[model samples]
Target: MMISYADSALSVLPPLLAITLAIFTRKVLLSLGVGILLGALLLTDFSMIGSGEYLANTVSQLVWKDAALNSWNVYILGFLIVLGMITALITVSGSARAFADWAKLHIRNKRDAKLMTMFLGCVVFIDDYFNSLVVGSISRPITDRYHISRAKLAYILDSTAAPVCVISPVSSWGAYIIALIGGILTAHGFADAGHLSVFVQMIPMNFYAVFSLLLLLCVAAFSLDVGPMRQHELNALRGNLFDETKGQPPGATTDLPEADTGKVIGLFLPIAILVFATVYFMVSSGADSLAASELPFSVLGAFENTDVSSSLFFGSLVGFIATVGLAIQQKVEWSMLVKGMVVGARSMLPAIYILLFAWTIASVIGQLETGKYMASLATDNIPFALLPAVLFVLAGVTAFSTGTSWGTFGIMLPIAADMAMGSDSSMMLPMLAAVLSGAVFGDHCSPISDTTILSSTGASCHHIDHVVTQLPYALITAFISIVGYTVLGFTGSLMAGLISCSVLFVISIVILHFWAKK
Candidate 1:
């Protein structure tokens, strides 16, 4: 039912109540269920209050009529099903066991186990969502075999996922940035100009992305652990970090399984297809140019008309289905395959709910024009040079609170870009980069973020457990980014800012290493 204000309040009350309940209960699913029920109740209450017909309409509107139903939800669900099928096939064919066995032979040490994960994360930089799922699933067994903590695994997965994509040029994220920048430039009266090219060329100067990559590299290279991460590593080193639920079959003494070459090939096949298809669709969609080709229309004409997310959703679905079919052909049983698919899809339930809740919150906030309201509240007393940073932080806060990075970007990017119109062309790239970085920064740390939930689920750790463990690391990176952006604001040299941030980041890591040991 379309809930009245009082009924809506009653409906929403349980989720808030659940949050408190979870603190005492530590029951993740129960907490999530409470939240979900609250959402349904809110809809139901509305319907009960002289809006019976509207209730069904509201439910349909919220769950089905929304853009999420047509796009993000379907894409996520499709990927989950695919992942499940792949997992079932691997388990049935004993490929997971085989891979674990191979890892035992080569990755004898804990540090190597962690490094391998970080490296794999870098290689799968095409999509943050894909990277989180693929890297975490593939590496989980190996890491567990080495007694690595799920908390640590979650940290590695989270760190590498978005950071890698924000800097990569071939991913869907890259396309979005290009399109946004193009729009921003044209809106600023720079239409038909090469402003976007200038922005792209200045990416290496994006201190936040560059420094983030360096931070990840340093963590991998030095094995520098701090806060909860350090504790987790120490526990692993003491041979007490593996989940009791994981490891070899009950009778098997060795934790690691023997390598199966066929399993590895099978695993890579779907991944390769997904990557290739993503790139192809991205290019064909006219999001960006990989090479020069002459046509009757403009070179960028394809992207001009193509909807990037639509292409991504379709391409990913196709790759997912193809991979599932291949797994079935490999003798994965239907029942077990279905079970795996169910589990995989189940893993995403928290994310789906969070997305839906976030969407509603954002939709409500938009109706009130919250971002615009906030923007208007910023007085003329604020320095013009600091406007970009202020907007960046504002966007970050919104995303953090709402736990929806795209929604945050949708509101703040246009505003920030508009504010930067009168600024130097060279400054626009860094500013935009700052906004993107801040959005990610907030999403990474927000307990409500979908990626955070997925990371926790993938690692089989408590969602809050992952959030608490990774907070310190995310904060350190964010601090570095803030400083980096500050430098960029004054100097307008992206390269200088990046270099400075990288050097400082290394020093901070060194400090953390000593502190962690102490």
Candidate 2:
């Protein structure tokens, strides 16, 4: 059923209910389920049978889209499971422990641990999912050895993932946004504008992304742990990496068997292969897509057309095979190999459940036209000088409510372009950039976000703990971004906006330092 409640105010209720309940109750699955049920009921006009059918169809689409078994959601879920199994095999082969022991020699303090993790997060900017899980896999041992909290590690992963991806033109986010910008420009008669150049131009205007990364570095360099993050840091320093009361997080497999001897090569080789293979596949997939289209082949064009879900799955499968090969080469018991794969698959069940629920609810919200409703409210009767600022806030709220930045980008970008045309054509870039920045900001804070959930899973931290601790930092960056976008809107100077954000960020850092001392 293709239904839209875009004109109805009730369109906003389901997501609001879910987000509010998740934050307050800290019961993510229950909250999402309730929201999904309520949205389905609303869509079906409160008919129980209709609602059930709606939900079943939505869930079924996760694996079957267009009556095909191959779906992006299925590929992503498969990647997670394969990656989990690789992680387990690495553990069983003793590669992870050996790598950790090697890291301990060089990462001598908590600060180094933090910075290393941040650096890794930034370097792996091809995709947020890749960044979150792989960086967590690589950095967890070092951070844990230094008594860094999983919450803090997850915060680093979360911050670095989307912010970096949003700004980096080579990333999946970059490719997607560039493609959107291309269509929007064509629609507005800027068909001659180079999409890549346009994306690069807006990079600085993406104040939320630029500043969120700056804030992440500041958090690491100055130990600027505020809000819930402060307590999490303190607890970590006191030898508690996670809240035992919350139980083991997804991917925290304690009963997995380990070999008596292992090599660091076991860890590095698989990760390197995974990263390289994934990138290669991404480019190859993009090339394949370009070949089928009328567009000329270019590296940027390739990325803009790539199938990221399939690439991740292929890459993880290769990595899993490498891990298994290494385990066998190490004379790891066959029984241990079987146990590791089984345990690894089991470890991802919680995350899989959450992903399924989150994906389904997101579909329901789409049916309800929640983002469309929110976008409508902000695009009307807005002053030209406030367009960028207004769009930033609007995009943030839309993404936060929808729990999907890409969806927000799709909903808001054309709307932003249309609004900009009515005001000032030159303001288009700033407005579009604001939408991107705000979407990333909202995604960072949204509990139902896949990146947020994966960041928690990667660090094996309580999901709610990661969400709560990361919110303050995301909010601070968002506030600075609002100011920056406002300056850009009024002055039409991207530099002015950049300066405004830079000054505010420094001021915020100083305040954080003094407050932490107090």
Candidate 3:
């Protein structure tokens, strides 16, 4: 049965409330938890009514449902744990500091430092969270040496991370797109079967993501400074980067600060291994075959069910254990080793809490089928000719609100494909590309986004500060994207739209550059 508007609204109410409360109160974790509990209560109340036994059953069903064991949840948790462990290892060995120091020796100018940060961000495009932490840690010292404000550094990191991944045909995001596109095709009655060729073909048509990438490169090349970014750049030029002694050394309190150098190579070994293993698995699994998979199990089986996050988690666990053993081997005190682990874990506490709450809220919404309901509503009211533009806006709004492009795509792609089937227009490719592009656009700008948060944390900047500074740049890129998508919808030519948008983006950067110089 179709869900009624009132019921759908009720289903979405908890998440909206949570988001509002989080924004208003500036307490993310608490707000997320409250939202999850509210959803749970609503679901239970709707089903159980006045029966105490049924209420208990509903609560149990909600808490212990097999639905919670979905692969995405497992992947997220594994990724977080691995990230925590790897970060700890990096902190303990001081590899991050060693890398930072080495970078400072080569990068002598502010522009060079900023460019290097952007370059690194692009290199680690596989996962936005990984890019954020690695880029922030390695580039922080170099940017500091050049007096680049943490805010500006964070802006660059945030801008590059998700946008790069969205356009890249490799990475975790790539897998998600393949899955979403396959589902979309089936829903639209496309006979292409299980292949991801359609998605691959649409990549070049993702005007927003492609243009956003160009914008980042242009900003880096021209050194364009706009809005709050201008103030940040000015502060950096005046030699006021970050005051390390202000709050607490990241990952350490004032009373129990550890030296920045203990065992650099030992710490980086695990992450290196993880990179190697991920590459090796991807290669061994036959990249083309995995990309062509029809179901989750096909991809899983290709990799022997060894997901990257799980592999990294286990690798990190080993690395941490080995690092601790090495400390013992070097006659370093066990207490010191334990202290490092504690400090590292503590540093990750905020990220961990955010992930937990984000996942819970996402799960709650999924259970209530909020995305499906929204998709139905959109398809019903939106016209065929306007679907591409409207889908772009809808995807953007969902992504911005949810802070997860994958989640937004998961929700919208099927509906968009279904809508396209009924439309008289032959703009399905354009519409699909718009959805993908718009989702990343929103994720790029959202303050609560994991990538956004990680970018700020990585750059050693205040999170809100990074958000404020980067907003103008992201909005500018988004504006260009909107115009580009509009052209593509009318003309049905992605190539022309992309070319036009790229040229305009480059010109905008050039103007901003000259203005910044003034």
Candidate whose lDDT is highest:
2
lDDT of 1: 0.62
- Per-model TM-score, in order, reads 0.78, 0.98, 0.80
Q: Write the per-residue lDDT of candidate 1 for residues 1-518, one digit (tens) a residue.
A: 23333312242344344445544565545654555444455545534443344334444555476445755455565555455445445544456676777788898787788889989988987677767767876787788888777788888888887767766655556546666767777887768967447556746655555666667667766776777677767777777653344331111112222223336555666667766776567566563333344444433445444445555556666666765666667666666556555555455555455455544444433333444444443445767666556655766665565455666666676766665665555566666777778777877876656777667655656566677778777778777777777777777766666766777787898897787668
Which number leads on TM-score?
2
Per-residue lDDT tens digits of candidate 3, residues 431-503?
7788888888777766557777667666766555676778777778777777777777777777767877877
What's the CA RMSD of model 2 in angstroms? Answer: 1.3
Worst 10 residues of 3 by lDDT: 248-257
lDDT of candidate 2 at residue 126, scale 0 to 100: 98
Residue runs of model 1 more than 4 Å from their true location after superposition: 1-59, 66-69, 235-262, 277-378, 422-426
Which lDDT value does model 1 have at 191? Answer: 87
List CA RMSD, all candidates: 6.0, 1.3, 4.9
Candidate 3 local distance difference test against the native = 0.65
Which residue pairs overlap in candidate 2's backbone? none
TM-score sort, best first: 2, 3, 1
Candidate 1: 10-residue stretch with minimal lDDT: 248-257
Candidate 3 clashing pairs, residues 3+ apart or interchain: 93-263, 93-264, 136-458
lDDT of 2: 0.89
